[model samples]
Target: MDARQKQLCIGEGFHNIDYRILKSIVDCIYEAVCVIDENGIVIVWNKGAEKLYNIAYKDIIGENIEDIFPDAIVNNVRKTGVSVENKYHSPRENSYILANSMPLYIEKVFKGAVSTDRDFAELIKLYFELENANSKLIFLENEVKKISGVFGNIIGKSPNIVKKIDMARQIAPTHASVMITGESGTGKEVFARGIHELSGRKGLFVPVNCSAIPSELFESEFFGYCAGAFTGANKKGKMGIFELADEGTIFLDEIGDMPLHMQAKLLRVLQEREIVRLGGEKNIKLDLRVLAATNKCLQEMVRESKFREDLYYRLNVVEINLPSLRERKEDIPIFIDYFIKEFSTRNSKKIIGTQRDVLNILNEYKWPGNIRELMNVIEHIIVTNKNGMIQKNSIPEYILSQAKKSESFKEYPLDLTKAIKKLETENIKKALKISKNNKSKAAKLLNIPRGTLYHKIDEYKIKCPK
Candidate 1:
């Protein structure tokens, strides 16, 4: 060879090297490399390709490419003489890899195709982990803010409420299942969220209301499903609530509402620490804490055959019973003051504190709906009375009628104008009911001018039921 030709051959080392040396060099490449002849026969199958597809080169070389591999990109390149880059899936390896394929030509004559593949499974796993971590961080921040000062979103300082919070905090760090029992609207979710924050888990908090999910979809929603697992299934499949809640807290609100059949399934998951999808054979392991809440008496339900006995015990590792609003009446004024400020800022209102008469009446009322009802009442008062101090007349009619005031009118001063307005409102409502809500007829029934009736209706903001 001439000096220039020898330099070229040496520069391209494989051109003059032994076949074994060239094969070793190809095997050293990290990415999968494969070359096919013009007759669609496999000529080169590197070590990376064997590792990626789990197929040995000995079995693949000299074999028809179509018989050894089902990848369509190689055939497409040979047919169209075009290069293509895409994500490819290998069913044998159950893996996905980035693949690039280009037509190979010898002196402008089409020969075959060469392809390279890069596996991205590890990168995809890391991406999901980072996303899950970010979600957990956001949730923890919010939970910290909610219970930051004294009791997070729970707005009570009474002994009953404080004791419950202390118990929640004590059990927060453990992986024990917590059962929060209370009447509806007793801030059960607040305690659940607070406990999750304190637990310091590195996964997002997932809350599922047992009563909200349809019975037929319960299994699919909780355990997930594989692609083509059932008719109408998503082609890519879906992750279940438990899988999504891995390394986090799953707050199952109203656990008593879970049907008997599903309760058995839940019991198995808790016991096994794993779940098999609705239409899948694989069992997915779980690392999660379950927090359940219910207004119903689970023990009683168990006795009555309404709830599973074993599942109840599994979920009742720790129990926190929230006191009703009436049981902790001392916290009423505190909650009222806090809510007044909260709703005032939210609604851009300048209204002030509740009057003594209103506070006394509110404290005496039996709040069947608990803290949630109290918040609603406060919101209503702030929205209805935006100009001055909140008055007793702003209270809902049902509450005012049911509430037992401790001090009589003689003991506590009353607003005469408000009482008169209330009386007038009652009369106008009765007249409208009698007249079937015909404004002119109602005015005649009440012996008032139609204009006066309109003014009174606007003044009271009365909404007549149709």
Candidate 2:
């Protein structure tokens, strides 16, 4: 009978009413509850307890509790001669049932233990589902990347490179505009491509070299005009980068060199999400990702009043700074192996091996143009290699020259620009003569970085025939 019914039926003669009161108290609890006797006979089972273990009091009252539910009793309580409790599981629904047990004493000695359970199945279910979904998304993301842009993903296992890759992956799936800052040739475009592919936007990667474009062509190049919008315009108007990249990415390289007036126009388009062609009357909606890259220190430019502060803030939401090749020297070996293979296959040359001294020359030398310079060096070496393995002597003279003139100065003095130019020239000549008319080897011989040597050769108006 129910507690209230038994109490009213027995009246003053109800001596076992205390058990009814105990049952009522335990029944109100949220978790499952079970009270067992010395012989492990279940004496009391609460309502919550019944739902958890799929057992009722009527079925378990006279039954041996251990036979029906040994796990439910918490065996530790009996072994240690003390009341014990812990979390237990009911695998039917893959549920977690927390069994909180304590000693039950009939006299001065402990008789049995009473256990209670709290269901934690819901929380466990949610976590597993979230984990599974995340795994699937990551797999699909990798699969989709293969079908996108041809720009290869930057590869390296070094700590520095891995961190940058992780950060790129984290921010790629968002709509936020990105500002990438790095030294020239430090794989800025690679990171930009990664962001574009991750955002799930359609279309292509349209690269605009800000410094390469003339000031007059900026508007026409960015936003295409209508067929009859301007004089001398083509009968069939072309789609602008902004319109062409309607649902894709537009990588603006050398953004630091973009004129101030154009910066304002770019900022306006970003804010309105629309662009107007050079001589067009209507505004075209743009849904493209804007990824800007710069080798110059933009913050310093902002301080010098060259770059606008407002424009900086607008594109500063997601900023990534790429590490220079010198900063990640550990990645040099792997990158060299990659580039060697790349160039060797293309040039039909068999470059069997690279000596440690050659790698030392590459690693120790400052990489001003970063990976691009290194790749070019690898291509040059492979194309000019007479033997299967390139030895220290066979390597570029510019690198060998550094060993000879290593003691020129401990530091490069900025004030002595004339002395610097003179040293640069002498070194360049030695590299050229040693390499036997090869600018690539001569660049390595001088100990001066390759890209800087290229620019210097151009500045001095020296001709190195291809």
What C-alpha RMSD separates each model from the true structure? 24.0, 21.4
| Clashes per candidate, residues 3 or more apart or on different chains | 2, 8
lDDT of 2 by residue, 172-257 (tens): 88888789888998988888887787777777877788999999888888888778767888788878878988888999999999
Model 1 residue runs over 4 Å out of place are 1-144, 147-151, 404-466
Per-candidate TM equals 0.56, 0.55
Report the lDDT of model 2 for residue 297: 87
Q: List candidate 2 stretches off by more than 4 Å.
A: 1-152, 407-466
Candidate 2 lDDT score relative to the true structure: 0.75
